[model samples]
Target: MVELAICSSNFTDQLALLSFKSSINFDPNNVLSNWTQETDFCGWVGVLCSRRRQRVTGLILRSMGLQGTISSHVGNLSFLRVLDLRNNSFHGHLTNEIGRLLRLRLLVLAENNLTGTIPPSFGNATSLKIIALARNYICGRIPTELAQLPKLQIISLSDNYLTGPIPSGLFNILSLSYLLLDANQLNGQLQAFPNNSLQFLDLRFNELSGPIPLLVATNFLISHNKFTEIPLALCNVSSIKILDLSHNSLSGVIPQCLGNFSNVLSVLDLRMNDFHGSIPTSFVEGNKLRSIDLNGNQLEGKVPRSLATCRHLEVLDFGNNNINDTFPYWLETLPELQVLVFQSNKFHGPMGSSKTQLPFPKLRILDLSHNEFSGFLPTTYFKHFKAMTIINETVGLRYMGESYYHDSVTIMIKGLEIELPGILTIFTTIDLSHNKFSGEIPNVIGKLYALRLLNLSHNNLVGNIPSSLGNLCSLESLDLSSNQLSGKIPSQLTSLTFLAVLNFSENHLEGHIPRGNQFETFDNSSYNGNLALCGFPLSKECEDNKTQLHPTPMLHKEDDPTFACGFCWKVVQIGYGCGMVLGLVMGYIMFLIGKPKWFVRIAEGEQQKKGKRSHKGGNRNGGRRK
Candidate 1:
C-alpha cells in the first residue's frame, strides 16, 4: 500500500508537468520536446526532480523563446522551490493557484510579456525570498501581503504599469536589500521609514513627489521626480555611490557637503534641475568620480578646477548651463576622459588649449556648439582624438556608459530639447556649429577616418570645401551649411559612398554639383541658398563651361508653362521688329517713286476746284451790284 501511494504521487507530478508543457503554444528551440511521458519524469528538461521522491523542485525556462500562458497545473508542483521564466515571451496573468506552492522561494518573471497584477494569493507564499517581475506589463498596486514575507530580500517590479503609492510596509522590510520600482505610473509622496539593511534603491521615472527620505542605501536613483530639495541626511550615508537626482523640480543652492562621498561616489548626475548658484567646489583629491553631468541646469559660475584631481573621470558634461568659464584645457590631464560636451553655454574666448599638453587621446565625442567661442577651428585639438581616428570593433565603448542614467539625457540647446541617446564612444562625432569658428574646415578633420558625424554649420568658415574630406570613408553626416565656404563642390566628395546626410546649403558653392555615388542621392535642399550651384534638382542648369558637354537645344514639352511663356514673348518681339522694318521699307519705296499718279491728279483737281470757287464768288458779287 505504501509503494502504491508513492507511485500515485509520482504519477500526479508527471501529469502536472505535462500540463505545463501543453500550455506552451510555441517552443522554437524544442526545449520542452523531451518532457513527454515516454521519458521518465526525472529526465524532463528544466525539471529538477527531488531525489527521495520523484517530484519537480525547480523550473528555470529563461530566454528559450517560450510562449503562451503559464499553466495553472504548475501549482500542483507543491514541492516547487524556484520558478524562473525571465527574458521569455510568456504572457497572461500568473495563475492564482500558484499560492499552493508553500515551498516557493525565488520567483523571477522579469523581461517577459506577462500581464495582469500580482496575484493577491501570492501572500500565501510566506517562505518567499525574492520576487522580480521587472520589464513586464503588470499593473495594479503592489499587494500589501508582500510585507508578510519576512525573509524577502529583493523585490523589483520596474518598467511596468504599476500605479499607486508604494506600500509603506515594503519600506519597513528588515531583510530587504534592493527595491526597484522605476519607469512606472507609481505616484504619491514617499514616506519616511526606519532603516534596514537595504542597499540599492531606484525609484526614478515615476511621479513620486515630496522630500527624499533619510534612507541608507549604496546605489540610489530618484531622478525625474518632484523633490524640491536635497535632504541633508543624504550626505550622512557614507556608503553612498552613484546618486542620480536629475530631471527633478529640486530648487535652491546645492549643498556643498554633497561631495562628502568623494571617496565612494563614482557618478553624480544632477542635470535638468533648478539648482542655481555656483557648483560646489568641495571636490578633494583621491576622488573616484567617473562622471559628472550637470547639463540643462541653472547653475552659474566657473567649473571647479579641483575636478582635475579625478584621474578616473571619463565623462564630464556641463552643456546648456549658465557657466561663464573659458575652455577648461586643464581637463586634458585626465587620462580616461572620453566624452566632453559643453554645448549652449556662455563659454567664450578663443578655443584655448595647453601649449605642450597631450591631446585627449581617448576622447571620441566632442561637442562645443552654441557658445560664445570664437577663433579658428581647433585643428590641433581635433588631431589628438586618437580614439576616433581609427576603427576598432573589439572595444566595447559602443555599449559602455549608455544606461548609467537609465535613459537618454535632454538638454535645451538652441531653444529645443536634444536627447543624447547614449554616450557611445564608437559613434564618433564633432559638433562646432552655432559658434564664431572661422578660417576653414581644417584638412586634419579628414584624418578622422572613423568619424561618423561632423557639424560645422552656422559658422564663419571660408575657403573651398576640402577634397581631403573624401578620406573619411566612414563619414555619414556632414553639415557645412550657413558658412562662407566658396568654390566648386569638390568632385572627390563622390567617394563618400556611406554619406547619408550632406548639407552644403547657404554657402557660396558654384559650378555643377557633384554627381554619382551618395552625392546623387542629395536633393535641392542640400544645395539651396547657393545660387551659383546648378544641378538636376535645381531649376538652373550648369553653364556649358562647367559641364563636360554643352546641352543640345531641345524643344520644350507643350505642357511646360515656362516654355509656353518664353515662346510667346519671343514671337511678340519678332513680330514687332518685322512690322517696324516693313513699314520703313514701304515709306522709303513710296518716296523713291516720286508720288503715285492718282495722288498727283487728286492734288491738281483740288487746286482747280478752289480757283473755280473763287471765280464763282466774284461773278455772284457783280450780279448783286448791277
Candidate 2:
C-alpha cells in the first residue's frame, strides 16, 4: 500500500507537468517532445528531480523559443525550487498559483511577452530570492508584498510599463544588490533608499525628480530625469565608477567634488545639460575616464589642458558651446583618442599641427564645422588619419559603441546635427563645412576608404576635385558645394557606388557629368551654379565647338548619333579625312606661290576694316576703349 501511494504521488506530478506542456502554443526546439507517460519524469528534458523523492526541483527552459502561457497545474510541483523560462515568446498573465511554490527560490521570466500585474499572493512564497521579469509587457505598479521576501536579493523590473513611484518598502530590503527600474513610466521623486549595500542602480528614462539619495553604487545611471543638478551627496559615493547624469536640466557649474573619486571613476557623462562656467581643472590621471561628452552646453573658456593626464581618453565632444580657444592639440598625447568635436563654437585660428608625432592618430570622427577656422585645411592631419584608412566593419556590426560604457556624440550627418547615443565606432566622417577654410583639398583624404561622409562645403576651397577621391568606394555623402572649386568634375568619382547624396553646386565645375553608377542619379541641382556644366539632367547643351563637331559624350548616351553606324556615318568619316588632306596640300601650294595677289588684297581689306573699328572706338572715348 505504501509503494502504491508513492507511485500515485509521482504520477500526479507528471500529470501536472504534462498539463503545463500542453498549454504551449509553439515549441520549435521540441523541448517537451519527450514529456510523455512512457518515460520516467526524472528522465525528461528541463525536468530535474530528486534522487530519492522523484520530485521536480528545477525546470529550466531558457532561450528554447517556447511560447504560450503558464499553467496553474505548475503549482502541483510542490518541491520545485528553480523555474527559469527567460528569453522566450511566452505570453499571457502569470498564473497566481505560482505563489503556491513555498520552496521556489529563483523565478526568472525575463525577455518575454508577459503581461498583467504581479500577484499579491506571491508574498506567500517567502523562499523567493531572485525575481527577474524585466523586458516584458507587465503592467501595474510593483506589488508591495514583493518586499516581504526576506531573502530577495535582486528585482529587475526595467524596460516595462510598470507605473507609480517605486514602493518605499522595496528600498528596505537589505539583501537587494541590483535594482534596475529604468525605461518605464514610473513617477515621483526618489525616496530615501536605506539599503547601503546596493551596488548597481539604474533608474534612467523615468519620471523621477527632486534630489537623489546618498547611494554608493558601482554603476549608477539616472540620466533623462528631471533633476536640476548633480546630487550633492554624490561626493559621498566614493565607490562610484560609471555615472551618467546627462539629458537633464542640471544647471549651475559642475561640482568640483567629482574629483574625489579620481581612483574609482572610469566613465563620467554630463552631456546635454545646462551647466555653465569653465570646466573644472582639478582632474587627475588615475580616473581612467575613457569618454567625456559635454556638448550642447553653455561652457566657455579653453579646454582644460590638464586633461592631457588622462591617458585613456577615447571620446571628447565640446561642440555647440561658447568655448573660445585654439584647438587642443595636446589631446593627441592620449593614445586612445578616437572622436573629437568642436563645431558651432567660437574656436578660431588655423588647425595646423607641427608635432613630429601624429596628432589624433586614432581619430575616426573629426567635426570642426561652423567655426571661424581659416587658412588651408591641415593636409598633414589627413595623412596621419590611420584610423579612418582602415575599415572596421565589426565595430559597427557587433559593438555599437565603446567597450564597457556607451559613447555618445552629436554630429551633422547627411546634413542635420543629430545626437547618437552609443555611436558606432565605424562611423568615419569629416565635417569642416561653413568655416573660413581655404586652399585645395588634400589628395590624402581619398585614402580614407572607410569614410562614410565628407563635408567641405561653404568654404573658400579652390582647385579641381581631386581624382584620388574615386578611391573612397564606401563614401555615401559628399558635399563640396558653395566654394571656389573650378574645372571639370572628376570622372573617377563615379566609382563610388554607395554615394547617395552628392553636391557640387555653386562652384565653377564644367563639362559632362559622369554617366555611371551614382552619377546617373544626380539631378541638375547637383551642378546648378556651374553654368558650364551640361549633361542629361541639364537642358543647356555644351557649347564647346570640339564637342559640337564630335559630340564626345553627353553622359555617354548610347542613343547619340555618334554611336550609330551606317552609310551616312561612313561617308562623313571619308569626307572628314579627305578634307584634312586637301587642306594641307592647298596650304603648301599657297606657301610656294609666295603671297598670291587675291590673298594680299583680302588681307589688306581685313586690316582696313579692323583699323576703322579701332578709329571708331578711339573717337568715342579718346582712344581708350572702355
- Residue by residue across 1-626, what tens digits does model 2's lDDT show? 98898888888889999998988989998988898889887989898898887889998898888989988899988999999998788889988999999999999988777889989888889999899997677879888898898888888886677788888888888888888887677778777676877877888777778777666667778877777756677777788777778777888888876765656777777887899999878777676777777878899898998788777778788888899998777777777888888889998889876475776778888999889998989888898888887654334222223333467666554455555444555567899999999999988787776677799999999999987777775577789999999998877676666677789999998887766767778888788899888876778766652332222334323222222211223433333222221232243244233423222212222212111112111111110100
In the predicted model 1, the residue pairs found to clash are none
lDDT on C-alpha atoms for all candidate structures: 0.73, 0.74
Which portions of model 1 miss their true places by more than 4 Å? 1-5, 193-196, 402-417, 545-626
TM-score for candidate 2, residues paired by index: 0.83
- Taking the tens digit of each residue's C-alpha lDDT, what string does model 1 give over 1-626? 98998888888889898898888899999999888778998887787878998778899888788888899998888889999988778899978988788999989988777889998888898888899997677889999988888888989997677899989898788998989887677888887766558777888777788888885777778887777777877767777677888878888888887665688888888888998999888888898888888888888999888888888888888988899988888888788987788988999888765554577878877888889888888888877888776655444333234233422333322223445434434466788888888898887786776676788889999999987676665566788989999998877677665576788899998988767767667788888899888876687987673543333223335322223223323433434222222232233234223433222112222212112112211211111100
Predicted structure 2: lDDT: 0.74
TM-score of each: 0.82, 0.83
After TM-score superposition, the amount by which residue 525's alpha carbon in candidate 1 deviates from its true location, in angstroms, is 1.4
Tell me the lDDT of model 1 at 169.
Answer: 91
